[model samples]
Target chain A: MALNLFEDKGCPLDRQRFTWKELVQPPISKLDDDAFTRVRVILMNGMEMEAIRFSHGCARMNRKWQLPLAQLRIVEQHQATMINGLLGADHSILETTIAYEQVAIEVTAAVAQNEPDEYLAQVYRFGMLEDFDHLYRYSAMLDRLEGKDANNILQCYTDIVPGRPTIVEHRAPQDNLREHYDRLRAAPITKLHALTIMSSEQQTQNFYLNVAPLYADPVVRQLYTEIASIEEQHVTQYESIIDPKETWLEKWLLHEANEVYNYYSCVQQETNPRIKAIWERCLDYELGHLQVAMNMFKQYERRDPAEILPGDLPEPIKFESQREFVRRILNQEVDLRALGTQFVNKSQEGVESQQYRQHLNASGSPTDMVAAGYEWFAGTELARDGEITREKYTRGHKITH
Target chain B: MDKTTVLGKNRSGIDISPIDIKEMMALAKVTPASSSGDEQAIAQMRQEYIAGADVLGSVPLPSTLKGMASTAMEKLMGKSPEGFIDKLGCRLAFERTGVRLYDALITKCSAAPMGAHIPLDRLHEFRNEEFQHFKLVENVIRSIGADPTAQTPSADVDGVISLGLIQVLTDPRTSVAHCLEAMLTAELADNDGWRMLIMLAEKMGMEDMARDFQQALREEDEHLVSIRQWFKEMVIKDTVGT
Candidate 1:
């Protein structure tokens, strides 16, 4: 390992704040190689913290909750400073938009890879295809509105292909729920995975909600609104997987352990020393938080921390490529959907559609507008994937106007 | 159905493997319980097996070599599990490489001197997009009841390609122009992967899947556009300075 991540001492609260000068330092190069993944590690951490910080405003915490909440705010602010310093001013909203999409892709995969249950994995896959399409739709906007190519930054690691069309992704809220895992017996990683993915998707939804109004183009704004709705459904899908039986204190403990575990991961895989230091520092801060949370759990729940957490955190999570794995799944299970705890193919009867028409009637499909915009400007309905994998998956499907 | 039978069941006894469970659930004929009075008990035991302990039961997880071997054995035995597992492995590997590439690029950009003109934020955005793709691919893999960590032949191909990109970062002499070129290679492969997937899904009668894959491919085309533009910018800047 490059460095041990479980050490206790962190930068004191007095030292966590960075000067404006430091925050404005040069952003990482577009070609530095580790820049995006490093940002992902940071962002993933941020998302989890944000989710954990707010999910437990339960009556049980009383005033004692204020302490951890204050601690969370300090650490969160420091994390924001670190990320802002890394971002600099050179990026545009379009760029941030693209990065947001990438975060969704990478983090969702990380959780899916770590998830032990097939049903939970299926819930994620349904949303994955929708976001994949969002990236493509937004790429079209980047080209049409800015007269700029989307690939300048994409660099071909992700194929900007369509997934389950955004047009059909919207569904009734009640339909989104999947069966919850048994908290007592479920893998700690699975709970952590659910929390991680839920927050990441929530962030994506919030990003679109925040930025949609900023865009001048109607289509751009509409696409954001359209996709943001799907993300809302995704949040519901992922959150429903958590066992509701666990006490808020138990959830808090898992949150802290999860934070430590993720920071440990970033420390292990980080190649850049500068970024690695940030991860290392944050890991310590999170460990402190974990210690505090552990004590609270013991006092409140009257249970050993080990009762909820595994003896040792499982191997640190890795964010590696899943190219073949995705392709294999696309071939076999592309048509599957969630029903109760089991995943069934599209042909199964419980696949409800009553609410879809009303939803579509409320607003003309933004996905249609996206396709129309592409046709009007690019003379084609679909953008090409270029030289990555062959565009062979959608061949027999109809391409409607 | 008894607690003894349930508790005594080996952790591995419930076969919830995506492939096996899917196939078993689809069977039309259930041997009408032997006319014995034990039929009700047997049926209840089966129901409990499916609903209660099946998910908790442990089974061998997916790994690259094991997935490959499982795939091969299924084919040999004429009982192929869904072939999606292998394809997802390839995508997961490629998306990770994409995320790493963007991260490296972002780090370098952030460290560049104040005087060095760079689109630092644009690079950050690109990295984010790749991360999203990474998540999407993994989600697809898990949806099919396989772990995304597994390696396969196609995934290895992606790994080898990413190895080359890492080489560019390691060598101090390689400049932004060289990195751009490496990115171009990655993008081309990504485009092909999406295109191929879309076509494959369509052919398999998965119209809904095809539409979604099409949406992703559109964004991929834009990725090619930006990468090509960035490369041109780097070349122009390099020529002027040199």
Candidate 2:
């Protein structure tokens, strides 16, 4: 039987079933590689105050604080796999491998060029350097894990030249960056995501913690553990950026709702089933996450912020702007307030009609108000297009105006 | 039926008259005959009368006032007393407004048929409750040396009440739910008004009234419990049906 990625089953190849105890031992021939040492040092050398400040600020703005532990683990696992695959691939897969890289580079360049703040440029530089370090660590891990030569993996990393028009110099570049960040932040954290990453880390962490047990061969388990710790550190870094005041439940719920909205929006607009399935599954995961969060919130006797706070409630998600709404109807985007005035005027006329009055008297439903407004607006549009005569207008005036 | 059997016959050396036995039976029957009806019919009538009677009986008395006052006092001690006072003012404002709205509606529909007047009657009952509520809260505030009316100006009072009335008339369930939410909010803000009312009454030396309000709080809790249980059951039924 073939393994299905969508379902729960063990790995396709059960090559070596290593216990937690055996995986953690250190290797004997530990060569201190220079580049790896440099990256590690950079990660460790940050000022305590700077770290604290960054952690505090990030936590406050950290939107994913409420995400379930299970979901975070899965995302981390997926990210690891993606990183590994990108680094281990040949020249043929280079184009696809560098897509995310290109995005990061472009964002960094744009920030550097357009941002007036010197400190912001420095921050971007630091972030870009960290991204490169991640790329290196991933490439190294991929080489060691597959028993492939380091030279081969290094070649794979270097073959794709950094794409140009790299720096965003435009005034509105920050807007684009903000939008990108918003979209990235919207992914739902799920139990599966959390479990996968944690399992992988557990495997890796076990390998590193028991350094003395496994001696001779390349301490592949130790290396895995070291990499896993880096991942955990990254997780902690992200978690720290999220405010501690907000319970994990609050953060997860917001993320889940956003994910569901995004998925539905995409599902409605996109034609591809595969793309739709991805979003649909995401929507399922988000809903599950929401249920979990709700359970936790109830246990604590705390209401969902979304339920209590005015702005926390979900707004109706819309794709089209005012311009789009007008363009679809009037061949151009008119001033929305002006359009509203026209609508209100037509509705006023409709209010005087017998049908409108009767509807109001019978049932004072908001739906009736909306329908009356729409009919009045439609009639106005028809009159503007010369589709109806004055006589017809007089006739309609009795029923709908 | 023999009258002698109905009442126990007195034994005497002399022959007792049959008239005496009849008279004794008549007196015995009169003792049990305060109100006359079939047992089931009487039981049904009693249930009907007691249904609304509990509403009055459950009201917190003066003794319960001290516990309620203590709660208010505790709230006053901990945070901005003004916030609590303002909320009480808002409640009073809404109650007064509800009364006026119900009165106006009743006046407008006086000529309508009895069938049409059912909703009006409900509104009237609710308005009457609101009036009682307004006075209750006002008295509570007054006991604490604050005037609820002064806190809520007369000009804004009508507008606030009208808004609540419109909401209630549009969707009674939603309006009731809103009131529940407000009650919950107030209780939470003051560390449970029901509990506090009991505490205040006890503190103010109104032990009996305190006990009454405690009973009222228990009744309120029962009502809430039933509403929640019913809601849950309905939701389950709906899901299953669907």
Candidate 3:
């Protein structure tokens, strides 16, 4: 059964009220080898199945319905390779640290060059910050492995960024509004660039969720859990961007295609044999992801769910409409501490709320307070505040609460 | 082998022009299209022109130049092999290879489980293009000396085309990306060939053949460009999305 986050009769707090803290927890124990293996298999298998299924679906669709199957296949193959490559990286802390650093640099450069829409830019920024945390977590894992200081391992890697041209070169300001609009629309469905932030976040979520459960050490497992939850937040942000009305299949397919395309493109340009091998492996993995998605679709085929749920659907998120997107640049600043404080406060409040108490009591209940909270907050205060603050933010300003 | 005397004197009286005879030598490398054109007359004229040229036999050229010179000499020496049979054979073989390759991929992709490999939709599209390519080649072959219906199957043709595709698909550097790069190369090569055929037809006053090849060439070029662009976009998308 699907996990629902909205309905609970026993919560003392109003049906709609909750905090972020109630939904998350820090690592309490280490992950054993069995747990790790299970999660890894599940995640990797799911991802690969999705990739293959999507590609096959596309081909079949083209053959039966006369779509551009060849072009779509090319895109699908590309995305598969990228996802596989990332997965193929050494699971060691040092390797993940380096990989994350490289991804951060690449994302930063892309943002600098294109100045993507506010949500996209925010996702990139968030992703970069998350990578730092990931670096730390992995370093901690490394410490556990080597019986040394995690901080030192982290410092060794993080220190390298300051000395390099970490940002992308600037291009001329684009006057082509239509082109930009098309880019934003097409970006999500295309290869690496997503139309919305959630798409990319899903990959992170899957990565952490899978890897977290696979660690043999408790500390490593805890760290993975923590990081995975953070990634889940990013996924939430992305999900909030999408229309809730979309069917699970549609959403899954789009995300799957996006991932496959990314890997496909990366492998194409990657000259390093190690990287290339990873890409090839990723292609197979993504194919699996597509297959999983297709199977899900097949399972759901008998049932008629709307393409998007009414509550889940929203107006397409746009950077132009997001005042925060504009504010970061105009203000030329972001208050990281302020944002952190807000998140922490909100989380603490949620944890203390009566609704959370009930949620804990009815842990296995079908009702989902978390989902409810997401809808309520996302639809009401959060949307309004995000829009309002977006106006004040400039292109390069630091984000704040 | 005096470079200055052979090339003619420069204003500075220096041997500014090198004694490279490759370019001059290549001028002789023309294959006759028909035995009916006064072969002896043309050869005599070519010889006379070579003798009259001050640089004749004055300087030896590079290996590449010598190869061209040999080709030129052969063309000058032989009568125009009457008929376009050889050209037709080359063209037919090339197009047939494209058709076969696409067909093979379609079969291969189809055999794989849905989502286990490339989508069937794309394979179908490729098959369509392959059919078109095959038709174009068939028409070319019929227009020349051979009857498309009567032409005997040659194992050599199959080997050459399949080998080329295998080379492309197996290359680690080339195969890393999606098959887009490989597809692009094939399309571009076919497009060039089509253009040449069109030109040849026009020169021969076979307006129908020229028109057909011309149209096919244009379409092929567009397909090539579009696929290439699509491949490029795919790369960018993959890079960014990850």
Model 1 residue A315 lDDT score: 77
Residue by residue across A1-401, what tens digits does model 2's lDDT show? Answer: 21111232112211212343332222111111111111111111111112223334434664553243434334323322322221212221212112222222222333333334343333333233333333333332233223222222121112111111011111111111210112123222221122112222232233234542332222333323333343343233223323344444454444434333333443444333433443344344434444554555566646743341122222212222121121122221111111111211222323233343354335222111111211111112233236557767788898883
Q: Once model 2 is optimally superposed onto the true structure by TM-score, how far is the C-alpha of residue B240 displaced, in angstroms?
A: 63
lDDT of 1 at A72: 65
Give candidate 1's error at residue A394 in angstroms: 32
lDDT of 1 by residue, A232-328 (tens): 8888887788898988888877777777777777777777677777677777767667767777788877888877876566777665544445545
Query: What is every candidate's C-alpha DockQ against the true complex, given to 2 decimals?
Result: 0.01, 0.00, 0.00
Q: For every model shown, what is its TM-score relative to the native structure?
A: 0.56, 0.22, 0.29
Candidate 3, residue A18: how far the Cα is off, in Å: 50
State chain A's TM-score for model 2: 0.30
Best by TM-score: 1
lDDT at B123, model 2: 44
Candidate 1 error regions (>4 Å): A1-25, A38-42, A48-61, A338-342, A349-354, A361-363, A372-401, B1-242
In terms of DockQ, the best-performing candidate is 1
**Could you give the TM-score of chain B for each candidate, in order?**
0.61, 0.37, 0.50
Residue A206 shift from truth in candidate 1, angstroms: 0.9
